[model samples]
Target: MSLKRRLELLEKKANYLDSGVKIPQDFKKFNELIGLPISKIPPFKELPIFGYEMDIISNIETHRDYALNKARGIGATEIILRWILFRAVQNKIPGRKFLIVTGIRLGLARDHIKRMINLCYNIPGIIKQSSQYNITINNSEVIAIPANPAAIRGYENVEVIFADEAAHWDLLDDDPVLEAIEPHRTKSNAHVIVVSTPNGRRGFFAKIFHNSESKYYKDVKPWIISEGLLIDRVEVEKVQKEDYYRFEQEYNCQFLTVRYAAFPPEVLAILQSNSMEYQLSD
Candidate 1:
């Protein structure tokens, strides 16, 4: 069947299933309806929903903006990707869009878009058009762009924005990429989801994660050997032996002091706090 005809049938089926009621807003329901593909684990074709994954999904559903400081290899990225797909499928308005801003490398952005296309290909009738950087479903679309100010601007009607590996974005005294996204997000009242492992004690990710007053709903997940699912105890031991700091920052989600900084993180924090207080008093 042609893509259009298949979409028409799918729409009819969806309408029949809902019986004129609003489409279900539950993520788990849609997840079960359209099973997620899992290529990492052999003999398992579908992604399993562990309690951790469910917790993250629940937070995403509840909060308009979320920041996740996740351990490496824990499937945080996978969950966000599936969430974007869920949003795209459930969207009822035309020209509603989703944007994914990946790390410094352009290749990372393309890879994310490719994964979205692959997911759409697995489930028929879900994709209307796809290219190297974007995929269209019905009237809604998902686009992946590089993590730069110029690349992020000019998109409108964005329903959700994902900053993938956000800690690694090339930032200066001010975060231009995040600054660029704010206008689009504010104009559309869009949800912004930032996911990344810790890089250092600085950058936009760290600032948002540590700021208690920020609007972002923040959570951190560490590698728990007792879980014995995503990362194993043996590998953790190896990385710990090689570089304990790397192990702590990467798997344990600790924002440690920079290796060669002139001042300790605590000292800098105190100085910054004092500066702010002085300004307020003056």
Candidate 2:
């Protein structure tokens, strides 16, 4: 299918999921379907990404055939959680499924799922627990499973797939989770979202983000704060005084001249907590 048509289908599915419409036999098990209101769904507080809105509406409005390579604490997790919750409350397929793969295991997975539920319930009429292992807003269906690639063989046709901390996911030798989830994509017009900070110098996430040749590589967006943008003028001089050029690059996301830089120059530039205290008290 053309990417545009695929994106249109994706947008329709997202709208259906968000509005809490029941899936018909073509997309569900039965003929009749229902509708749920947006107020009854979980609400997400949008945050700044490179100073732009989180793009949840746009992200949900189309099929995400791409991945997100983001800095840590950049609101990637929060948005993905919102999308998964949307599906959980309104899935149409029999045994309609949503899966989250983290670097952690079952106990942690359950904890994360509970946190999502709390976020959903915290929003008032948007979400409520229909039963254990089931969350509903306007009859959406969502379940977050802690998965290791080796153990993820049985689940099929997952409607939404999220890979968290994906930079660390490559350490697993038998990552069947990726394999298991691929078939579901064509069938469900599946939405796959992967988010992580750079882990090593390179890996799956890195290759996809850095190298355009990878099959999964679609669109790449990088967010960087230019040097001197966040740093105080006084502190910039202090980093120069300390000769910590390497410390500055990592945090500031600047190009570095240092070899094997553990602490890039940009970070060192911003490391002047003592000076801030000195200024505050003075």
Candidate 3:
């Protein structure tokens, strides 16, 4: 049978075992191998203080690939990273791995990993101790790898791919890091999440955001915040009247071109969401 078909069988057998029906003694071991209850797994909601639209997470849960480019302070990285951790731990499939790739140094990478580790450690019933936080409930690995092309090419069978700070990578050079991981997602249920704040002008992220197939192009869940969000409209006009063009376009989520002008006032209205209603204490 194909790997996909075999996995389906294992899933079916696991469900039957969960229902407490009597299977043959020989099949007991197989059930133990595959069955992973949610209560015994780590809860991902414990990480980071994110305040984004519900529709954003809904899109991620439904469609696996997302290319999100937005202004800073939108909580893009934290939201996606938390989602990755949540999915990895909640469904404890053996050999499952989630890789977080970044253009920053290894130390910075560990900072994010450490946040995830602490979240897992603090949650009481969700995740039991399993070799610290580097490994998950059923030995599923949540790893952070640097953006070097050579290092990324070695991994296989990764379930989720998160490319953070994507604007830092050069799109013209064939993007070996993306090339290596894209093919490994042969499973129909794989997820690829790319997120970044605006950086200068051109890059791999810019191309992806422009493509029609990209989630951004389709307007899955756009929450564009610019100077208008932070400062009063008339106040901004007075502070940088001559350079208002620069401040509005760069700090705001505006796409600058020679002929076309700033976003119509109506488009910004369509993209913006209300301030996040935080439930972190819950």
Candidate 4:
């Protein structure tokens, strides 16, 4: 409103115009460098990417066998979903096939796809096409299958497998699934991302966490994420009395059974089988 303020604003606009900021070609550089929140852009503005979220994205970019064990509502699926969109606009991705194991069923995973499509709806140059079990982008394809309640086995030609909630999955020994995922590692430098809260301490997810030190896998925990303001210390303290061990597993990323737990780790392991008894590959 004032003359001085108007002059300062004009100078700022002129300085911005004069600034020589090249548009980055690489997605990582683009993301880390100059990519602003969708809200910064008019007409299609959305939310900003948080620090912890960006760290997860970085992990996805850098690691071949990355594992994430984080609390609920912490945004694991979201960061990856956004990353997929970024890749879709990249002209081509590093791999052709992307598989998402829901650890429950394709039905449970359905919401994820819906949200993904919605997120990309206003973004230019990115298109999402879905079939019964697969979603295809420009040069990349994403498929989702279940690991429990019913087994969906025989994953073939998979370049990346996003194993969601691996702790809840039924395949304890991980026969067919491991066979499918591990082979792709050496074959394609394919990334296998195992994400979950601790169900107990006797499954494929447990193995991944315990072997976090191994070269075969890289582990990421929520505490390592700065700007983790979403975690309220008071809320965590309040929930401790209700279910302490489960809380630790879910929030602290510990692999332990809950006190007075209905399904103990042993029973869970007993019901779980190594072999994929019913192979339903799509």
**Best prediction by lDDT:** 1
Question: Could you give me the TM-score of model 1 versus the true structure?
Answer: 0.81
Residue-by-residue lDDT tens digits, candidate 4, 1-282: 357745754554444334532323555544433233343224643345676777777787788778887776566776676666555545354337776777655675887677666654433334447765667766777767765322333544556777888777766465456555666677666677778877777777777677736554455564335223445666676667787875687777787865678987788776677346756688
Encode model 3's per-residue lDDT on 6-98: one tens digit a residue. 686567656544554323333223223332112212342212232343345666667677666555544555556656656665554677778
Q: Please report the TM-score between candidate 4 and the true structure.
A: 0.68
Off by over 4 Å in 2: 1-53, 105-108, 122-141, 170-176, 215-282
For residues 119-204, write the lDDT of model 2, one tens digit per residue.
55323355545443445554444555554554444566567777776665546442345565566567776677766655554445
After superposition, which runs of candidate 4 have C-alpha atoms over 4 Å from their true positions? 1-47, 91-95, 148-157, 223-228, 261-282
lDDT of each: 0.78, 0.50, 0.55, 0.62
TM-score versus the correct structure, for each prediction: 0.81, 0.55, 0.59, 0.68
- Clashing pairs for model 1 are none
Better of 1 and 3 by TM-score: 1
What clash count does candidate 4 reach? 1
Q: Give the range where candidate 1 is weakest over 10 consecutive residues by summed lDDT.
A: 15-24
Candidate 4, lDDT over the whole model: 0.62
User: Counting only residues 3 or more apart in sequence or on different chains, how many pairs clash (N, Cα, C under 3 Å) in candidate 3?
Assistant: 0
Ranking by lDDT: 1, 4, 3, 2
Backbone clashes in each candidate structure, one number apiece?
0, 27, 0, 1
